[model samples]
Target: MLFNSYSFLFAFLPLLLVSWRLAQGYGPTGLALVLLAFSTVFYGLWGLPFLIMLAVILGMNYAFALALAAPEPEQAQPAATTEAGSEGEAEAQAKTESACMCGSRKQGGCRFRLSRKSLLGVALVLNLLPLLWFKYSAFLAQNLAALLHVQWHFTSPGLPLGISFYTFIQIAWLVSVYRGQVTPQGFTRHALFSACFPYVISGPIVRYEQMGQQFDALSPITAENLAKGFTLFTIGMVKKVLLADSIALYADSVFNAAEKAFPLSGGEAWLGSLCYTFQLYFDFSGYTDMAVGLALMLGLKLPENFDSPYKSTGIVDFWRRWHITLSSWLRDFLYIPLGGNRQGRFMQYRNLFLTMLIGGAWHGAGWTFIVWGALHGSMLSINHFFRACIKGKTLERILALAPLRLCSILFTFFCINLCWVVFRALTIEGAGRMYKAMFAGPFTREAAGLSATTDGLAGFAAMVARWLPNNYIQGWIPFALLLVSFFVVWALPNSHEVLHGRRDGSHPRLGWRPTAAWATGLAVMAFLTLILVSRKATFLYFQF
Candidate 1:
């Protein structure tokens, strides 16, 4: 069911589009039903059991939302039909209306609010249960076993695809319903919202409010949307096939070496880390592009996700740019509720730490992820403190200089790169080995077990001899590719900029336009991506 797969591009999408176009004449409801049926088929492709789970969750949430909506009290008084004859009469009428409004508010406050909150809590727990069992059971069991000094043997259940994403989406919906931010759409629209194939897997973590109107107004596909969608999809395809997968070769080799406890030179460590940094960016961002494109083709608009995160000068800025949806979700749902800087300096820091800790755990069931989250949390807290300290100081003026700004950007990128090591590693020990090699002395390959022949320059030379013959060109290629990636990332206009007609001030180049020439170029890019799609790699975020 990967969008990159030929079966999807050639078969599923085409069939669905044709069916949708055919159904458009039948009206929006018919078109929506078509979409819902196709979405169900898509989910069913993963596994019938999981599809059943999704259906039950959707049904349960829909039922809860309906119940929550039902108890909404009606207006207590009807409007008066006769017009006021005098000023005194008008004032008396206004007072009566005000009193009625106040009484209605009191009634809703006493009954509706408490019931809605209880229903939302129930829905949240029910929706999250599957995610908890499938995603975290192993991590919990192992930790509990260690603490109690008992060997706990339990077979972990397989995690259903997109469980984390869909669960979060539903939770957001429940909360919105409780707060009266979203009205309960019927089962059909709610189901479609939850299971839209483009986002059901890896997502921008869409909200019901964002897509509910579009679902009701589902329109026929248009040439403008088609061109824009195709262009976006092509750009994403090139990024994934040409850039991410190509860099992944080098990144995989180095990470695999580290996993095997192979000794790494400092040069190799940095190069590999850099490759992985770009690899992850292109991989996840590329997926987001395809998702957005696919949604656009269907006349639906998904929220933007990535916004050139590497260019960020601070950790907070980086989070705002990278995984924009997830960050916003955590802020609104977790951080704000936890008193998000409103309480005091200490509470703000505590909230930030806890939010990131939960955010990291949401990615996977591993201590590495927890530590990675902690790293960002700690840095963000320090960043906030630094900002506070510099608010009215001469140091603030110094940091605003161009060179300082560039240094800040580089420093932020470097910190992010280091964090990615923990995020990508198989274990904390593996990440530790990589970090040690990354910071080791230039000629100290011996400590990593690369050479045992001598203690001095001879051992270094022997290590060099062993590495040079095999990796000389291999090493250079990744560095060269890394340079190209850096140029593209820092210089070229991103997909959003190009598609939206914004110029890249830093490096103006050819921009995307819907012309015959551009169309041909897009076709060629699509062809090349199709050729590479046989490699059949899934997106990195799919695991989460």
Candidate 2:
């Protein structure tokens, strides 16, 4: 269910809040069971069959891990009896069991060792099979039709909701388990950690180890967490309802018109593209904010997804600022695994390329998605090379000149905007036409697609008929909202810094400030939610 929906916001959330608080008095295990059931119900809203399918997959993954950790017959042999047995074997065995009693107990140690590679292979296969079946089935089917020289079609497979996130979560969980980072915990807790609803649909991708203790225990609902969560949820709601959806109006018109019109003139082409760029940023980031806030309401801390990406001065900085969770996920799970920076310069470049290509493919099953990923990947690599060549000299030179820094920021934004064309376009041809119109078209008179007065000339009348007013305020209120939103984002301290306050034990009062913030946040959010309720809108990334 959508967080923005009335049913979710009013009915479901209230019920959940009451249930969660009541369950909290029981204990962690009880709370986890409650959460697990709640998560399943949330997911089950899609359909009963899909929920069953998801359950089977989750069960398979959990069982696979158990199988990997289970002792084998060959592993039951005493280590001392083996010819290769030595101090290393004894120490390894001790660490595998209980370190405290290994030597003192005077018991023969088992020689079996769990293979990380084996476990990872199983996890990757399990995750990849369903992803391929659902996401790429149509692509493959079309290819097969052409190759066979016959008519053929395939029905689309049932894609479980949040499969994209759950797949990645399981992959990460398996890696942590293989690395021995996972603490001893019951299977119910592990299941809850992986399938928790707030993060499941669109994730900040929580790590298994970070949540291990939270699954075992939780703190009571405090004024501080409530205040912070309410503030975040309110801000996010405003971003989604007021800012993102408004831009989407113009974006939808322009892109829809582009599919039929070969090339668009200035106002429709450029402004439309710009609308999409802004729309996507607010929509995705807004959803993440709400998700984080909701998790906090439940006394769980989810990761932050975005920083101010537009404020970034370079492409490298842009990645660091945008979709932080996904970026870090790619870095930790994919980039580091491909030998990281340790294998020398050439391998580093190779890893960058491969990671980006895969990352692009991850966005969708379409060529447009692939191109979008490639565009960003190439930008990142170029930025790396540019940094190496300039060293500190580039920034130092810019610092000496204010206009230079300004130019750099503008250039970075323009480049990022250019990349968004690939992301927004429905087809590769559509992207090419948009770019052609943007760069090669005439800049004046009728050709520019701006309105021309009759006094100007006779030749201008026909083309000028197509021109639309450029008043920013009349068409897109959300554009104005974005201006306010950006001001707010810049006004606040970084989320990580704000989060640090909660952990550092700095705010000792537990008084009115927290309560006031929550109240204000809730009021603003409720007001905005009411305003946007009439328009049915889907989350931007839901298409992917």
Q: Pick the lDDT winner.
A: 1
Q: Which pairs clash in model 1?
A: none
lDDT of 2: 0.71
Q: Which sections of candidate 1 miss by over 4 Å?
A: 72-114, 392-394, 444-475, 502-509
TM-score of 2: 0.83
Write the residue-wise lDDT of candidate 2 on 1-544 in tens digits.
Answer: 7878887878888887778788877877667777888888888897898788777877888766665554332333345755566665655555555322122433465344344466569677977899889878887787788889988867878666677777888888777766667643567766788878888877877888767777666655666687677667766777788778877887777676666664466556677777787788878888888888887876888876787777677888888888887788899999998987788767877788788878888877777778878877788878887777677785657644868766777788889888888788888777776776566544455465455454455545544544443432244564565566556444554444444443455642322254556577568767867778667587877655
For model 2, the superposed segments whose C-alpha errors exceed 4 Å read 70-116, 144-150, 392-403, 444-522
Best by TM-score: 1
Work out the TM-score per prediction.
Answer: 0.87, 0.83
